[model samples]
Target: MTTTLECRGVTAGYLKERPCVRDVDLTLAAGEITCLLGPNGAGKTTLLETLAGLLPHTGGAIEVEGAPVRSGRPRDAVRAGMVLVPDDRALFRQLSTKQNLLLAVPERSRRSSALKQVLQYFPALEKRLSVDAGRLSGGEQQMLAIGRAILQRPSVLLIDELSMGLAPVIVTEILEVLRRLATAEGTSVLLVEQHVHLALGSADRAAVLVHGRIADRDSAAALRADPGRVERAYLGTDAA
Candidate 1:
C-alpha cells in the first residue's frame, strides 16, 4: 500500500514539559481508514492536531506522500493534502450551507461541479443549501463539516471525535460515507473515536492509545475477536 500520511516519534501538548502525546508513530495508507481509540484525556485529539500541524510537535516528523509537514503550519499540512475535521464542526454559523462549501473551493469555475459531487455523497445537504449551517441538526452540521473537507480534495483526512454528541444511526450513516470516500476517492482517513465497537466495525485497523502511548494495535477484526484485550488496554492494565 502507498503511504499517504505518516508520523514518527511525535510529542505534543499545551505545556512544553508535560506532553499530552509522546513518541507516537502512526501511518495511513491510501484508501485506508484507521481508527484511533483511547479513553478520554488520552491525547487522541492532541495526536491528530499534531499530525495536522495545528499544534507544534516537540519531537519527530510528519509527512504526506513523502513531503514533510512543518509543525504549527497548517498551510504546510494543507498544501501536503492533509485536512483535519475538528471535534467541533467549525462551520460559518451565519453562512448558508452553499456558501460554507463554496469557501473551500478557491476556483470559482469548479465550485458548481465540486458542490454537485459533495451532494452526491450527502444528498440531504442539497435541500439545505439555502439554510444557515448553524440551524442544521448535529448530523447535518457534521455532514457539512466533512463536505467542506471533501471539497478541499484531501489525500489524508484526520477526523477528531466524529461520533461525538451524535446519535448511533447518524454515526452509522456518516461512517458509510467515509467508507465510500475511501473506496471511491482513495482518501486516507485517521478517525479519532470513543465508540470502540463502531470504530472497529468501520476501520480496517485499530490502535489503542493509553496515557499518551500506544498500548496495542492490530487488524480491526483481530481486536473485535479479542475485545477483552482492548478493554484491558483502555483500563491501563495492558500495554503493547
Candidate 2:
C-alpha cells in the first residue's frame, strides 16, 4: 500500500540545538486512520508540528503525496494535499461563520467549492452562518477547525487532540464524521488523541509513543485487548 504521509528521521524543536522529536519515522497509508497514543508532554505535538512544517526541522524530511516538505511552508503542505487541524481553535472571532469560511479560501473564486464541502460535513455551520465564530460554543469551534481543514480536500489530514475537554456525545459526533472520511471518501487521517478508547474505536491501527519514540505499533483490536502493555506504559512500568 502506498502511504499518504511519512516522517523520515525528523528532528525538530524550538531550539535548533535541542530536538524534542528525535529521529522519528512514521507512515500512514492512504484511506486509513492511524491513531497516535501517548501521555501529554510525550512529544506527540512536536512530531505532528514538525510533519506539518510548523516547526523548523534541523534534519530529515516529511513526505506528503511522495513529495518532500520543508518548514515554514504551511501553504505548501495544504497544496500538496496534506492539512493539519491544529489543537487550538482557529476561528476568526470577529467574522461570521460564513465569512470565516470565505476567509479560508486563498482566492475569492475558490469560495464556492470550499464552502460547499465544508458545510457538507458541518451542517451546524450552515445554521449558524450569520453568527460570529467566537460566540459559538467550544464544540462548534472544534467543528469549524476541522471543517476548515477539510475544505482544502486534503488526501492526508493530521488532527491533534480529537477529544480534549469536550463532552462524550460531542466526541462521538466528531468521530463519526472522521470514520466516513477514511472509509467513504478515501481520506487518510493521523489522529493524536488523549482518549485511548476513543482512538482505538476510530482507528484501524494505533501506535503508542513513549519518551518520544514509538513504543508499540499494532492492530487497534490487539492493543485494546492487551491491557498490561498499555497500563504498564501509562503507569511508568516497563511493558510486562
Candidate 3:
C-alpha cells in the first residue's frame, strides 16, 4: 500500500517538560480516514501538531510520499501537500467565507465558485458563504475550516476534534462531508477526536494514543464495539 504520511519515533512537547509525544509511529494510507483516540492530555493534539511541523520533534522522522520533512517548519509542510485544519479553523473572522477561500489559494484565479464544491460535500456551509466567518456556529465554522483546508487539494488532511462542542446533528453532517472527501478526493486523513463513537463511525481504522505512544490499532467497527480498549490505553487501567 502507498502511504501518504508516515511518522516514526516522533518525540515532542512544550519547552522544559516531558515530551507530550514520545516514540510515536503511525501511517496513513491514501483514501483512508485514520482516527486518533485518546483521553484528554494524552498528547493527541500534540502529536498532530508535531506531524504538521508546528512543534519541533526532539527525536524521529515524518515523511510524506517517502521524503523526509524537517520538524518545526509548518509552512514547508503545507507546501509539501500536508494540510492541518486545526480546531480553531484559523479563518479570517472579519472576512466573508468567499474571501477566506480566496486567501486559501492566491494563485488560482476565478475560484469564486469554490464554495460550490465545498457545498457539494457540506451543504450547511453553502448557505453561510456571504456571512462573516465569526458569525457561523461551531459546526459551520468547522465545515468552513475543512473546506478551506481542501481548497488546495492537499495530499494529507489533519483534523483536530471534529465533533468538539457541536450538536450531535451537526457532527453527523460534518462526518458525511469528511466521508465524501476521503472517498472522492483520495485524501489521507488523520484525526484527533474526543468523541470516540462518532469518529469511529466514519473512519476506516484508528490508532489509540496513550500518554504519547500508540497502544492499540484496529478497524473502526471493531473499535466501536469495544472502544474501551482505547479507553484503557489512555486512562491508566482496564475499563470496567
Candidate 4:
C-alpha cells in the first residue's frame, strides 16, 4: 500500500521539556483508515497535532507523500494534502453553514463544485445553509465540520475524537462516510476516537497508545477479536 503520511521518532507537547507524546512512529496508507486508541491523556491529540504541523515536535520528522513537512507550519501541512478536524470541530459560530464551508475552497471557480460535492456527502447541511453554525444541532455541526474538511481535498485527514457529544447513530453515519471516503476517494485517515469498538469496526488497523507511548499495533480485526490485548495496552500492562 502507498504511504500517505508518516511520522518517525516524534516527540511533541506544549512544553519542550515535557513532551506529551514521545518518540512516536506511525504510518497512514492510501485508501485505509488507522484508528489510534488509548485511554484519556494518552497524548493522541498531541500526536495528531504534531503530524498535522499544528504543534512542533521536539524530535524526529514528519513526511507527507515522501516530502518532509516543516514543523509548526499548519499551512505547509495543508499544502502537502493534509487536513485536521480538531476535537472541538472549530467552526465559525457567527457564519452561516454555507459561508463556513465556502471558506475552505477559496477559488471562485471551484467553490460551486466543491460545495456540491460536500453536500452530496452531507445532505443535511443543504437545507441548513442559511443557519448560523452555532445554531445547528450537535450532529449537524459535526457534519458541517467534516464537510468543510472534505472541501480541502485532503489526501490525509486527521480526525480527533469524532464521536464526542454525538449520538451513536450519528457516529455510525459519519463512520460510514469515512469508509466511503477511503474506498471511493482513496482518502487516508488517522482517527483518534473514544468509541473503541465502533472505531475498530471501521478502521483497517489500530495502534493503542498508553501514557504517551504506543503499546500495541495490529490489524483492526486482530485487535477486535482479542479485546484483552487492547485492554491490557490501555491499562499499560501489555508487557506484563
Candidate 2: worst 10 consecutive residues by lDDT? 231-240
- Residue-pair clashes per candidate: 0, 0, 0, 0
RMSD of 3: 1.9
Off by over 4 Å in 2: 107-110, 235-240
Error of 2 at 135 (Å): 0.7
Greater TM-score among 1 and 3 belongs to 1
Pairs with steric clashes in candidate 4 = none
- Put the candidates in lDDT order, highest first: 1, 4, 3, 2
Residue-level lDDT of model 4, residues 1-240, one tens digit each, is 999988899889999989999898999899999999999999999998888888998998999999999999999999999999999999999999999999998899998899889888889889999999999999999999999999899999999999999999999999999999888889999999998999999999999988888999989999999888898888888533
TM-score of each: 0.98, 0.92, 0.94, 0.98
| RMSD in Å for all candidates | 0.9, 1.9, 1.9, 1.0
Model 2: pairs clashing at backbone N, Cα or C within 3 Å? none
Two-way lDDT contest, 2 vs 3, winner: 3
**20, model 4: CA deviation in Å?**
0.6
User: In candidate 4, where is summed lDDT lowest over 10 consecutive residues?
Assistant: 231-240
Clash count in backbone of candidate 4: 0
Candidate 1 Cα deviation (angstroms), residue 69:
0.9
Report the candidate with higher TM-score, 3 versus 4: 4
